[model samples]
Target: MATKDADKKDTVLATAKERFEYALSRESENLERMKEDIRFAASSPDDPWQWDEATRKERKNNRPMLTINKLPQHIRQVTNDIRQNRPSIKYRPADDKADVETAEILMGLARHIEAHSDADVAYDTAADHQVTSGLGYIRVIADYISDESFDQDIYIKRVKNPFRVHMDPDIIDPAGSDAKWCFIDEDLKEDEFKAQYPDADPIDWQYASDAEWYPGDKQVRVVEYFEIVEKKTTLCLWANGETSFKDEERPESVMAVEKPLKERSVMKCECRWRKLNGQQILEGGDDGKVFPSRFIPVARVVGNEYEVDGKNYISGIVRNAKDSQRMYNIAQTAIVERVMQAPKSPWVAPAEAIEGYEKVWQTANTANHSFLPFNHKDEAGEPIPAPNRTAPATVETGLAQIAASASDDIKAETGQYDASLGQKSNETSGKAIMARQREGDNATYHYVDNLGRAVRHIGRIILDMIPAIYDTKRVARILGEDGEAANAILDPDHPEAFTEVRDENNEIKRIFNPNIGLYDVYTTTGPSYSTRRVEATEAMTAIAQGNPEMWQVAGDLMVKSMDWPGAEELAKRMRLMLPPQIQAEISKDEGGQPEQPQIPPEMQQRMMQVAEQMETMGNELQETKSDLQKAQQKAWQEEGKRIKAEIDADKANALLAIEKAQDSAAAANPAAGQGDVQEMVNQAVAMALANLMQQREPEPMPEPEPPMEMPQPEQPPMDGGMPMPESEVPQ
Candidate 1:
């Protein structure tokens, strides 16, 4: 055992040391690569126009030479082997003899090529074009660099020699022998690679930014800087690669012209697939010694380009940086959330249907924002109503009794009960308990109920589900994280897991916390609308003897849930046995009043007198009050009428004042006033304000004193005189 233990320790140590060394090497290499990238980025910077120069120069070739305007008067001789028939191959100045010789040589070469070959190699010939002279070979070299994988370089043959698609196989591997796709650096055994030749500084992404990541842009978006004729946007990618945007006007190489702008608009996602490839090149020296100049990138995916039809689609990329896949996901998820949570009723439901269906409303807006649903639809092809929770054991005899077994017998003998079941059952095993009863599941999962405890159906649903799914999945996913996240996300059901959770004081709780799920349930899945929780209480049948109030309110709720009333006998029995307080609540809930709840004779008599006096006084007060309210209302109405009349008179005067102001303005400045209505407007505004301030509104009248309530003596006191106090009269 000791030997085995020692060996295991040594193995662990070796593994740890290897990992540490590997990590250290990778860090050092990355640091060096990063430094070179920083230097190159600083020096060359990102020349957005660098490729433009190459693009312009790459198309046509122009050679510079001076024309012999005035020739020197010195005698110039013809070349020794010049053709006499051809235009005299001579120069006027002897100093310019070199040009004469160059012309002779070109004529001789032309003759030689025509004599040797049938055709003098006119560009883009059909036959014999494959055969190339030394001069023709040089042109082929240019095509090699121009050819791109995505954009094939093509050259037309006849009327117009457009760019053609051709790739020089030599670029990849001169011979297709032993070509490898990926490679790693030989010096560093720790680092990995992907190409046959590994570049020191390699970039992964073609484009990136500190810009917010918008997954929604894939759906609907405006064209990039769109215009009628064209559109463009300046996109910057800080990468280590040589990248180019394919010019949409004359699309070639990648987006070549044959794919016309009229057909379709283009969209692309350009990642900064840049690489920092380092090379040591000699600067200047006769000896030709080498030194590192600076690192440069080989390739990159830059801003995308597009060309819309001039009449139809101004040139630009259609969907800037996003694609349709993302849009589809959003649409799917939104549709699912909509269908799953459509309101049950199109209009307000009757109160009868909603009386006890309190929690049913919570589903109205519980849009579970994900792309999954229960796959339901009404016959009319619309979404079904809503998620009405399934009730327990549907309207039958309320399974009021639970079967007990040997375990229950022992517990009963000892006068103890399981907390899950309440004490009302008093069921014994092999006799009152129906010990043979069990469900379709495995025996290990079945157990006899012990009385006096309450088992909520919802809680049981959650508990039963845990053994099958989420608990295991959650643990697996958390463990798959950075290892430390495991502690925060592990099964709180385990005491060991709780040990990892530290409180504010950094003290570990050691014991598992049951409230974890309860708290999590509230925070993560709160109801969208208000919902009253349905309390369930099934008397864990064995132990009802010890405690009746164990599941008190819950039991009554479960019974009064007589919305499905097949279990009338059980409810009746439960109600009869309930404590007085519970009994009263039950009565009220059942549309009944409490037992013997009524007024006594003396109190009744007093109440009658008070009511009678109130009624008489109410009648008298109504008559007087009606008169006063009507009079006040009428007076206010008359005042409003007077005010309206005044307003009308003021409005007419204001209009007349405006007209007068206009006449004065026109007269004072005849040239500017006919169309200049400013004076009239000012007068009108002033007069309106004056009129509004001058008129007074009617004020509200003070309320009349509340009418007095005088009691009518039950017995008119023989002469209608007031009765004396109880102390003075005979009691």
Candidate 2:
């Protein structure tokens, strides 16, 4: 087992070394070009104007090699524009299982992650480097949120030095998102390496002496290498239409229902990372960690990528401008040298003319002298002209013209003109000025667009890792588009897998779930919130000025667009003063409750008087209703009493008749008993009372009429005491 382990380690180390060497060799030329581009762009003291050592040495003695760097100004113009309008990550639903709400939550979560990790710094740095050196890099990684927590959070980390990164040369994508392998190299001193990896043996500097960028006497190279590994796996399409890879860990419930409707053999790609050196796999060997995302975590931002003869070439704004800048520097230097070489007011005369005024003539150019006496005649007694001072030489127009042309060349190469650099140009109209500035923007837009692509890749990486990292039930911070921070409950095990949040109308306003759904990532670059607000304020102000009536209707909105302090409060107060109809329309648009329209004092008094009148009318109507009810109830009682009296009278008459009949019967049949006669009379009385009571049944009382609708009072005009104009009134 020990020998087998040793052999495995040896094989891994050999494979890593081979891969590293292949990448290094493939990207050597591109890397060297990128280094030169950076050196030119940086304009450091060591390489000012990127002059060659031979030329610099030749001019070291006396020649002026002035470096008038114009590249940085152009670079800054592009970079700062991007900063003002930063790009943001956005997510869209790509499948039936993914919903817009979930996409929104994911977007918010991504924004929160970006804010937490200071991803703006990373983004800006990458863009700056991309503009400077043709290439820049950012990477995503998972780390513990703190020392005490086992939970992990994803972060976008900036690669400050692009040269430290080496990518697969065969990558075809401009953003390098398709790269299958990458290496992030770092060098640590011997003691730091020992402290970081106490158990592992450091690479022997003597053994790997021939390696480039590695195994120095005082430093050791450690690489964080990422590669995509493929494995054959079975993908089960469940009966419910959901699919899962067999290699993934699933719950028992899912396993029980694992009767697959269809099965397929597929190759799955997984990204794995390792910390290794030339001699050994230091951190990740057989137990290396696999990234949650299939693509490598590193994101590359490239400017103006192209192919020449099947070989890839990447360039930045500085590449084409370098020559123009060098030319400008040389021309300016020549002009300075010419000016310095010119004599300073040298007197043109014979030596005998200043025979006794040597000191005076010597001090002529350096100091102010009262007078200088010179010989008017030569030794042969011939009259000689007085000494005259010669004028200094002027710089040649050709040299000045060359400098001007070189300056224009730099601007042309970089696509940055006077208008774009905040300099006044010949354009008289604002539109023409803006159009010229836009031209410059269009020329350099690729650099910013490439940064957006890289940022989109970063979003994908973060989205892919979110489910795996935030798998537990917890609350995560999220941000709205306005950068308002809020918390979202992430529950991966819930049956629905998302929490539905409803608005006032009981409609789902948001779905908070970061662990479920397949979403597509994108990036949008636009004016920031504050910038947009300022623009909105300007637009509203202009519109209001053009149509003064608009202020009466939408003054609150115009005020709200302002970014000054107390603007919101002032807007809120203004909203209350708006007409009720306008307020309602605005509220409907904003999905908020309409504020009550403010009423004038006179209007309030009128409303109170109308209310009082309605109350009085209602009281009188109620009293009338009560009186009618009482009268109806009394009439019913009297009718019932009369029916009762009629029933008694009928019973009495029937008893009399039955008594007479009984007497007659008893007389005819003397044998009839007296008790039987009395019983018959009693039956007659009962039958008579039942008939009378049935004939005199009382009618039920009718339901009272519904109360009359109270008349509505006329609404007072909302514009103080003045009536609203016809055009201003709501239709």
lDDT of 2 by residue, 128-243 (tens): 88998788999999999999998899998989998888888788777777888888988778788889889866773224434544444768778887888889999988766677
On lDDT, the candidate that comes out on top is 2
For all candidates in order, the CA lDDT equals 0.29, 0.81
Please give, for residues 362-402, the per-residue lDDT of candidate 1 as tens digits. 45346453432342454467654443443222211211111
What TM-score would each prediction reach against the true structure? 0.17, 0.82
Q: Which numbered prediction scores highest in TM-score against the true structure?
A: 2
Q: How far out, in Å, is residue 238 in model 2?
A: 0.7
lDDT of 2 at 403: 92
